[model samples]
Target chain A: MEELTSIHNQHVKDWKKLSTKKFRKQTGYYLLDGWHLVNEAVHAGVAIHQLIGTADQLDEHRELFDDAKAVYAVTPEIMKHITDTVTPQGIAAVVDLPDAHRVPTQPLTGAWLFLDRVQDPGNVGTMVRTADAAGFTGVVVGHRSADLFGPKVVRSMQGSQFHLQLFEGDLTKWIADFKENGAPVYGTQLNPQAKNFRDVHPGKTFALIMGNEGQGMSQELLTATSDNLYIPMRGEAESLNVAISAGILMFQLNQ
Target chain B: MEELTSIHNQHVKDWKKLSTKKFRKQTGYYLLDGWHLVNEAVHAGVAIHQLIGTADQLDEHRELFDDAKAVYAVTPEIMKHITDTVTPQGIAAVVDLPDAHRVPTQPLTGAWLFLDRVQDPGNVGTMVRTADAAGFTGVVVGHRSADLFGPKVVRSMQGSQFHLQLFEGDLTKWIADFKENGAPVYGTQLNPQAKNFRDVHPGKTFALIMGNEGQGMSQELLTATSDNLYIPMRGEAESLNVAISAGILMFQLNQ
Candidate 1:
């Protein structure tokens, strides 16, 4: 019920720190902006540490107060300082990071997406969203890839993060684990040895590895995979966008 | 090459004006940032009105000066002022807009993408990038769609703007024109009446219509199409990202 007006307020400083990876790691929480994302977080039963909003936003979403732990009325300027978006949506929430390390005990039992150094946050987010829509088990963000919890990634994922298990770490070790459990690791490549993605069938379990935006897959990662697949491009384009390529591959593999 | 330090300098003022659509139109030029984008524009033979960079950046890419008309050395602060990107890449360019209207004079002879009210700049840019990779004839940005030359769009497209024709106008008129010229208009939808995208051939000449991010398509536009198609999704996602959906449909229709 307290109001935060000044830019130098301690609470405002802590909220702004969420934008940095170090602070997020230390606090185990990140800021979610906009009513839509906040609503999704609430629906997913995400623990809300605090709900901060401008007077107008608080008036509009007064119903949310019934379940919120704490609510504070903040000025538009203060709201903008805490949010990552260029234009603050007047509402923001601090939500706990879901325990991402808990992968399902069962092996990936459907299509799965493995990303290798896919640096663009938006692309990474779109791939996650598409993988969820295509019924994939989960998305594994590789060593050099963008942080899965980055604000842009969260926004682009459109709440799919709740539906999917996201893990970050050594992709090679994870691939070895997947192989040991009988899941085929399908790495996408431009070489002639690659099969058309459409030729693959959606089965009980499999992993599709999408590489970097420009560099493709690392040689070691590509060699370790069981199959190399490609989405046949009839056009003059050098390659498809990584996210789009992932979406098409997911659809074809699922079909 | 002249150095421009004052924010009120005539050229600096003009370059800053590019952030607005009206100025870009009046000048018949647009701003592009980052080394990758500038490299793309250079390779595409786009006329560079000015190349502004910090001393370090200019020193690194000195060879690029072989073709540049004018190169200006400025402080990093000045570079940031003329660029839309947060980290500016220490470089930005004002380049001529290609004559997109003239490039599509012939009837659309391959998969074409028609965007209807897709307001997200990133989505529009990604769609154009996908269209380029899929070898579509061109992309028609509807009246309500985001401007193709916007900074975020240019970044998301990843140089695809140079490879494809971008037309902006009324969707109904363009759809009717394509239909009359023997190109079937295929509108993507979720209705049962719509055929699965994989099942549709689209022959050799057709246009695929992707609707708004929130609302799929206008009823009038949907009714005007020659055929309706949907990308079959097996998962719990309500819908695919518009750009990803466009990619799926474009690739399928091309196939």
Candidate 2:
């Protein structure tokens, strides 16, 4: 039980760097800021590289020490210095980035969600959680979408990241793979000419593509989808929030 | 054409106060940030108390001046001082708060969404936008929900606030009113005993209630509804984001 009271500690400095995507890429690990996420990672068998917390938090959650390879007790000020949140939750974990390329050997199955440059971390995270609730098997976060392990996205995902397979890759290739395998890939747009989502009935294996906050699905991916779908808006609202639209489509298609 | 050069100007000082809920209530006005929201407010025929902008913004949107009762040109620094966003869009507005109690004399006809103690500003705004997209005619925001006009909520709303009637009131009373009028009021929760939302077929006039983010619904409201409804979860995620749940429920109920 090593006690590190200085925010200048090398380990603390390294954990603080996890806040940036480039740093997380340089080192295959990300920081989980609160007890809820840390607990979820441990329960899901994620490899905990290290666990750092205040003396009181470490004592209260002493059982979690068994799962971590290293544990350090620091003052609240040091804990705050290591996490990005305005008020640190007093405990954090450094977990190895799960392998995104680990798609099962079996044929692609179940509902899959593809993000096409969805930029907002909150929107990206909410859609992932909704995909999990809707029974989607995995999410292929397209290039230009918010980094999956960014602090904001991780906080919003609320531990659903561990429940579903998440990958970052080219959306065009993912759509092609789904279509070639005979699974329907539905692209969403506001165009009236597109088929209404309710009219398109999908089977157990399908993919839904959500686009960017403003520009929407790239022209390439739009052309790549099997058929484009649109949710019927009966009111004067110009469009639904990207995350909202994704939830509606996921629930409807998964049925 | 009055040009104000100082952040200390009385008008600038007054506009800055609008960022707080107390001042908004005291003055019956709130600030609309950016060109998008200001333009929407003008087009929607909302009463614009005053329009404040930097020199370039005033010139570019000169046509909007006719709709605003008073327009003031200010230095970029003053514009920044008046707005809450990190980068002031060079334009902002003071809009008289629309009367929330102005429910139509006619019976409530279209679907109405009710938010109970949903505290996240982003969640509140997204749900409002979704309600509009789903053709929900109005939203009754109950006590403890985020202030509808808060900066984060207003930003996330993206002008959908102008598309729907938003009310702030007691959830119990709103639920009772709908029930008394013979329209089924559905409450949402995660308990297994609650009826599945898919099984409940709502007509054009029913009301749906969404509760707090952490706590699903107040016990009182859960007991008061015609029936409590739950969206069936097929995966291991504990629950849906409040806004996502609201979106799924609103779209499903409207359909």
Best candidate (score: TM-score): 2
Docking quality category of candidate 1 according to DockQ thresholds: medium
Q: Candidate 2, after superposition: displacement of residue B163 in Å?
A: 2.0
* For model 1 chain A, the run of ten residues with the poorest summed lDDT: A99-108
Error of 2 at B74 (Å): 1.0
- Candidate 2, lDDT over the whole model: 0.88
Could you tell me which residue pairs clash in candidate 1? none
Q: How does chain B of model 2 score on TM-score?
A: 0.96
The per-model lDDT (C-alpha) reads 0.84, 0.88
Q: Candidate 2 has which clashing residue pairs, if any?
A: none
Model 1 stretches with alpha carbons more than 4 Å out: A1-13, A47-49, A53-63, A86-91, A190-193, B1-12, B31-80, B85-95, B101-103, B190-193
Cα lDDT tens digits for candidate 1, B138-226: 88888878988878888878888887778887889888888899879999897656887877776888889999988899999999999
